[model samples]
Target: MKAVRYTLISGMLLLGMVFMKPTVVVSQCAMCSLNAENSTQHGNTQGKGLNNGILFLLGAPFLIGAGIGILWYKKYRTKSPKQTLLSHHS
Candidate 1:
């Protein structure tokens, strides 16, 4: 029960952080920055798209990992009485 409550609160905080993020997240390495700057200077939208795409890709893994972690916790949290007793004995 405590774990469930903590998980819910943590999930909500993560979501809030995600949703309230800054608009222009500069996620460029040296080479990437050079490329994006070159493209944007010529009025191409691809640079902006690239930056946003990178941001999205960066966030995807964390979200997936979080989901998998939540699922794993839910699955393993429900121990049978026998299993609980065995663990406690050890």
Candidate 2:
């Protein structure tokens, strides 16, 4: 229990630090990155939008997987009461 509590606290603190100041992470393939950079240099918003869309797509699967994992963990971690069979003697 103590280990679990400490782990949870540590995870929360790490997540807090991460969320405190968000930074943009490049999530583009080499060809896509080159194209986006080239288009942006020419003053086109399409490149910026493309980057944003890529970031969204990159984060979505992990976000969904994390959500599902959390749900599964919670569902299994909980303990349910067990029923006992009653036998009748004639």
Candidate 3:
């Protein structure tokens, strides 16, 4: 069952990566978008940097949450029934 779950997750991740588009999505407020556009129009390369920064910022929370979740899973899932019994009896 664990192997099946791992295989399924791996397949889904592989499929998502295969189908994912390599498009830049800058998630910012309207004013920020306008400012970025204006800067780009003025021949400044700051807009690209801003976009990359936004992507990094946007990804940080999800990465952190995933790390926390994996840690929690490892802590809870690694204990066998025999280990639990032995620990409690000591």
Candidate 4:
């Protein structure tokens, strides 16, 4: 176990040393404004359509629950306790 731990630590140190080189990248075109191209650009069209379909599927339950809750509130909001009891008795 101790040998394995020492080997792992030394491997990490060696990997770090191997990646420590810094190189400068020179670009000719001047840096443009931050908001130069704010338009939506998806390289894959099918992925966007699939995402919308999945979102609608996931949102269906919440929409149904909201509809049911609204209907329940409208059904119960305007009724009195006596009316509820009378309906249950029938």
- Give the Å shift of residue 4 in candidate 2: 13
Q: What TM-score would each prediction reach against the true structure?
A: 0.58, 0.62, 0.64, 0.36
**Which residue ranges in model 4 land beyond 4 Å of their true spot?**
1-43, 78-90
Candidate 2 — which pairs collide?
none
Which has the better lDDT: candidate 1, or candidate 3?
Answer: 1
- As a TM-score, model 2 comes out at 0.62
CA shift at 7, candidate 4, in angstroms?
71
lDDT of 3 at 28: 83
Best by lDDT: 1
Which residue pairs in candidate 3 collide?
Answer: none
Candidate models: Cα lDDT each: 0.87, 0.84, 0.86, 0.59
- For model 1, residues 1-90, the per-residue Cα lDDT tens digits are 876998999899999999998876688789988988998899988988888888888998999999999999988886645457668878
TM-score of 1: 0.58
Q: Show where candidate 3 strays beyond 4 Å.
A: 1-15, 18-22, 78-90
Better of 1 and 4 by TM-score: 1
Candidates sorted by TM-score, best first: 3, 2, 1, 4
**Could you tell me which 10 consecutive residues in candidate 4 have the lowest summed lDDT?**
31-40
Question: How does candidate 1 score on lDDT?
Answer: 0.87
